[model samples]
Target: MLAVIRERYRAHGFDEIETPVMEEYSRLHAGIGGDNEKLAYNVLKRGLDADAIRGAAGDPAALTDLGLRYDLTVPLARFYATNRGQLPSVFRSIQIAPVWRAERPQKGRYRQFVQCDIDIIGDASARAEAELAVATLDTLDALGLEGGSIRINDRRVLDWMLDSFGFTSDERPGVLITIDKLDKLGPDGIVAELRERGATAGAVDAFAAFLRRPTTLEYNPYGERQIRKALPDGAPDDIVAHLVGIGAAVAASRGSATELEGDIPLVFDPFLVRGMGYYTGTIFELAHPSVDYSLGGGGRYDGMIGRFLGQDVPAVGFSIGFERIVDLVSERTDAAAPAVVLVHDRDVPEGELLALKAALVREGSRVRLEQRTKNLKALLERAASDGYTAFATVAQGTTPASLEVKPLA
Candidate 1:
């Protein structure tokens, strides 16, 4: 699967690059990750710094100078900033690596997991969003996951919705955070949380009405249509055009790949307030029909790179939830069996054994060589259980030509 991902990204002109696993503590705590900042595993100051921390200080900020990276996006931004002069004006990058978080571990959630991300920096056109969405969906289709849906919503749409409800600038952030929990809490739960967070009864009522409206459109199963009916009276024209353009691009791209056409649903979901604080424009999430949670998500962050370089760099990215996708794929696919297992007697000549192993490998066979055990039956039984389909035995003075392959029961 990783090979497939590498091929897909490289095929699209994204060069793979790796950034340090640990970044400066201040960078990790930059508030760009939203709630993820609170989950960072701060590295304690070491040596003399540790001694100073132990002696005095009301806050630990001085004691912590570094932290494990919470995500690949931030590190990539920093990398691009430090090496911008050497890199292409329009940089497309692929980063597949592990990130750490101190959050609670669950079935699909973990303290340490891999993230597969591809980002295009320097392209502000809606074409960047469309290409990213199409390429990622194609990768999923290549992996045999066809019954999934892509839900997209622009941050501007959320801004318009909040303004329509008369939410003040100071109040909008808190309200957006609550709305992000709509999937887990439901509409009633969101309203309750909002009221508890100081939203007025009228504001809560208005927000609830917006969610209940039949605005969310599923483009694949249901046909395509204008989303203007769902927007507020004065929703920005550019935002509406962006959504329509994305839908059309995805639809047009599907023409050449008929087998995968309509197999993956695409929808416009207004309530998808992806928890990241850096998302400035379009945001999207991928969900499988059989699963209740998102497989992964990403969006445009035109302002994020500028925080590092002091100049705006438009960017869009998509991440595959590595652990969750692997979990789902494992459940549906059978484990592959090894082609052959070579069982050699301890007294067998080392040179002959090496020759046999090398010969099998040269023929492109998956092979494992193990010293023959006194309990040969038990050894073969264990190998068979571990998905070895065939075995070859080496005798005390056997020549490579004398060995015969035996099929496992």
Candidate 2:
């Protein structure tokens, strides 16, 4: 599955890159990862005595200088800053690696897992967002999955909506966090929670009224009309236009056609607030009808690189939840080499058996040597379960041409 994703990414002109799993403690805590920061695993500083550890005023920096990365984007930002001179002006990179989070494990969630990410840096246009959306959809198709769609919303629009509702900048973050729980909390619960959070009463009332307003959220292909319908009158014109441009581009570039409006999977989600704080513009999540959660997601973080270089560089990335999608894949598109087992007798010389195996390998076969056992049926069943397609008996001086291979039942 990882190979499939890697090949798909490379086919899209993204160059593979690697970064260290560990990063400086400061960079990881740079206030961008949202709740993931709280979940980060901080390493204790080495050579600290029990008293020294207790004496550090409970500051994490006092205890640790480095920690494992919680996501790939932060490391990528640092990588671009450090290697900007050598990379292309418009760089496309592939990062397939494991990231660690110190959160409690849950079903379909792990403390350490692999993420398959493709990022485009140095392109600020809607084309950057479009390319990311199209490429991710293509990769999902390559994995033999179906009914994948991208739900997109811009940070600008969210901020605009909040401000229009009279939310102060200070209240915006907390409001967005509660808004993110709309699916679980519902409208009334959101208003109640906001009031409990001591949000300005008028702002809460305004927000509640907007939520209660009549809006048709029916199945419509995400376009200008659906986008307008989802938001109040007088939403930012530039953000709306930018989203429309991305939809049109994705529709044109997509590999498959559908009956959905515009025949594109792009949909405008007015309430889709991705938790990553660094996302400065166009945020998106990949959804498949098969499951309730997103298979992958990403967005533009045009300001992140600037933090390291003292100048902003536009960047957007999409990461497939590799662990979530692997089990959901029912079929594989890439064919594996034929696997063959050498069921050999004890009397056979180890060197001769190895020679036979090597000969088969040179001919493009995956060969495994197994000693002949009395329970031949059980051995063959185990081999079949392990994905060996065929087996052959080997004896003294048996050559590749002389061995007759039989297919496993």
Q: What is the C-alpha lDDT of each candidate?
A: 0.82, 0.89
Q: Write the per-residue lDDT of candidate 1 for residues 138-162, one digit (tens) a residue.
A: 7787677876778888998998889
lDDT string, candidate 2, 1-409, tens digits: 7887888888888999999999999999999989898889988889999899889957989999999999999999999999999999999999999999986889788999999999999998888888888788888988888679999999999999999999999989999999999989999999999999999999999999999998665766778888888898899899999998888778767643422435788778889999987999999999999999989899999999999999999999999999899889874321357789999999998789888999989988888999999999999999888878899998887888899998887
Off by over 4 Å in 1: 49-51, 55-57, 212-226, 256-264, 331-338, 384-387, 397-400
Best by lDDT: 2
Candidate 2: pairs in clash = none
Candidate 2, residue 108: Cα displacement in angstroms equals: 1.8
Model 2 ranges off by over 4 Å: 217-219, 255-261, 331-336
- Reference-based TM-score, model 1: 0.90
- Give per-model TM-scores: 0.90, 0.95
RMSD (Cα, Å) of model 1: 3.2
